[model samples]
Target: MSSIWRTMRGIIAATALLATGLGTVALPAQAQKVLHRGNGAEPETLDPAKSSGVPESWLQYDLFDGLIMPDGKGGFFPAAAEKWDISPDGRVYTFHLRRNAKWSDGTPVTAQDWVFSWRRLVDPRTMADYAYFLWQVKNAQDITLGRKAPDTMGVRAVDDYTFEVTLASPTPHFVTMLHHHSTYALSKANVEKFGADFVKPGNLVTNGAYMLAEAVPQSHIKMVKNPHHYDAANTRIDTVFYYPTENQEAELKRFRAGELHFTYEVPVSQMQWLRENMPAELHTAPYFGTYYYAPNLTREPWKSSKDLRLALNLAVDRDILVDKINQRGEIPAYSFVPPNTTNYTQQIPDYARWTQAQRDAKAKELFAKAGYGPGGKPLELEILYNTQENHRKVAIAVASMWQQKLGIKVTLNNQEWKVFLSTRDEKKFKDITRHGWIGDYNDANNFLELLRGDIGKQNPSAFADPQFDLLMAEANTTSDTAKRATLLQQAERLMIEEMAVMPLHFYSSRHMVSPKLIGWVDNLQDHHPSRFLDVKP
Candidate 1:
């Protein structure tokens, strides 16, 4: 931090360059503020309209600016939009864009860009898992289903700088949802010119603090500061490199070797070792997400066998899995929604009060009833998860438990992130696949909507109970807080009773951050943008 230390460090760096015979030492120059980050997986896409996973959001949030952006306090504040107004009924919102806001190409970012991007989001022709996120908007669902025109889907450019949106009904958390990548605006001109290839590094015109510099599948993504960004003058991080380190152990090694300033996740396998050795670098905080296994209900007994579903769901010891495997301070999940969600009551499962022995006994009884235990034929189930060390450990533990207690064979299948995503969606009886869903916002609706009886890729369980769907629909229409909470609670209970998806553990962010990295604040959503971070000497 002292000027003398900085000068000495520069001399040491110059001496090292001379020692290596790379080049002659010259006048010192300003250091480039670059951050090498260990991203968990390769991003599926850079296009905001089609991005589905956290890895993709990490890049998209840096390259695109929505009307609002995360204020890093578990809430949103104006970004592209300078200010906004809401109607008294809260059914409509109008955002006033900054006249100075410009894309990476120096073109003005207008309200029309948002209108076009939103229309594409709900348009059936454009494939995206999060398209249904905008279903609360008036006619958005109808447009998605091709029952209405795209222009009729409730958003419009009132002028070059003013964007207006209308919802079918009042949504209290709608503004909060605007910070998600699915709601970010894109340049219509850029998309129209290059079509689907507009997201390529040389073609993309980003509006956020960074622009795509290079992209290599499975290797790394490079981004540099955008000079034309609205707040470019204040942006600190000049360059960022995101390495797809799905292997948590390898990622931690890279962090220890000083290759990465930060990591997406610290390997749970190395939790104790990290705590003992690098206590200052280890950053763990409560995260708004849930890890679970979704059964492929489109195939075999899973479609009709409630007993089979319940047996498998009740068999897993969530307590042991959380306490033993994930020592990163995660809570056992008995419900789909994470605990402490804003204004939402936690939905406890029916078997929550039962002892582990009682649950196991019940699971054995149900497995036998479903024709799979002592009396019936053997059942072999395969659990598919991405190639992450934590996932593998959890799968091996669960398989071992099932083999020991229930007298059934369990197979573990591991695939790369992209392949695993595609394989899980294949309509076959893949049995079960490991999945994690981080909340887009603080509302319980954000968590519950993943199971909505729709044909979207987000609904991996293929759960389509008409009664359960009705409860969620009613909750959507209910404006009163107490009534809505009751409706959502009933819906969550219904899903658990039916064993639609097996609940695992609620997430806690586990990252290893360098002490030199300043302005890295922890929040419920676990969102930390590179623009806000600065490095010290």
Candidate 2:
């Protein structure tokens, strides 16, 4: 670890030299308008279609412009496509591209770029895990399944400035989906020139408010204002430094020392300290996300023993987990969807209504029925989680609950962010593992789709229910927003009732934001694009 850290530091130093005209070329630095932030993890990739996790989103949102951009509030505003028209049937969408919009290289951003990028995302060869998002587009699913060609995937460049799209059904949230990274346009010429290395700092060509200046792996990602951005005149903060500091305590120390302008998370244990000492800097709000643990259903115990799964789910004391252990303002979640999601009602499980004593009794009854008990060979399992201090605390606390209440033996395993991502994607974990989901859009379908068996590896639990799949399909096909919402609610309830995964708590964004940073607001998404912010100069 020490050697790795040293190497990362060396790389950062070399990149800084390149940025300061020590290498191939010289670029002027204007006024040193820089914002330093502490990020939770290093991004594994910058490719929009393949990227997942919050760390990647931080960079992607700045480096590329989609047709529409999320406002951090519930609504979306125009980006590359300034205006668009939807057919009365809601199946066809015609987008009018911004003629003045240009890439970092000063070339016009044509509609062909968007068509090419969207087709690449849904193409089977790309294997983008988020390709399921394109299922709304006509022939997109067929193309991804290898039954149709990419050219036939319902996206067409009508002219240099006109792009046309056709959806399989009337999707109310289709515009919301356009704001996601998966729908961002990529520079086809640059992608072809660099191939797999297209996202490297010097090779990247972006059309957003900022473009990649330098990227040092595991150390920092530096971005500068994009000269060719349509709204470049309004893009404040000439440079943004994203430091991947996963340890919350370490991040707090940096923030206290005035080295960081903002941090992505605050340690739960330090909440009281922050409140008492630096109350003005601390901020909190309900975020549209969930923290849960998924049992690997392909293996033994979890796959064969439904009674055992129920017992384990009932064993958790979410009230204690949130109120005592977490101490943050997170809501204890009984359902997959959170309470504040738009257009849908959150379901409350019957077990959630039970008292702690009642839950304990029910767990014990289920355990005994599953043929595992205190005396005759206690059930042994391990909980896998990413290496975060807060996750460790929660794991230990939950482990204690299982041991004390059900007399089950539990072991804990930890991995870093990159390894954990692969482990979850490849289905290599043995038993239950820690997992979380943040909605891509403010819709119930985004959360419920994770469990759809048709998604393949995205459903880490490998859970499959034909009835649930049918309900979701029906919901997607109908144009009635009310009926669609009802179906989604039913689907979410079905998922929670079966105990496919243990829902721990709905998340709250706890962080420290310097008062000097202007235009920052607390929203349910907790997404504040750097383009909207400026340091008090």
Query: Per-candidate TM vs. native?
Result: 0.94, 0.93
**Which tens-of-lDDT digit does each residue in 95-178 have in candidate 1?**
999999998999999989999999999999997677899999999999888899998989999999999999999888788888
lDDT of prediction 1: 0.86
Q: What is the lDDT of residue 203 in candidate 2?
A: 91
Tell me the tens digit of each residue's lDDT in model 2 across 1-537.
Answer: 334336557866776788787666655454457787788987878999888788888788888889998665545799999999999999999999999999998899999899999999999899888888989999998999999999998889999999999999888889888878888999989899999999998898998989999899878899999999999888888888888988999988888876778898999889888889999999988888999989998898788888888888888999999998898899987788887788888788898999988988999999988888965557888999988899999999889988988898899999999998889878899898999888888889998988988886678688888889999999999988899999998888888777788889999988899987887788888787888888885
Which candidate's lDDT is highest? 2
Where does model 1 exceed 4 Å of error?
1-29
TM-score of candidate 2 relative to the true fold:
0.93
| Model 2 clashing-pair count | 0
List of clashing residue pairs for candidate 2: none
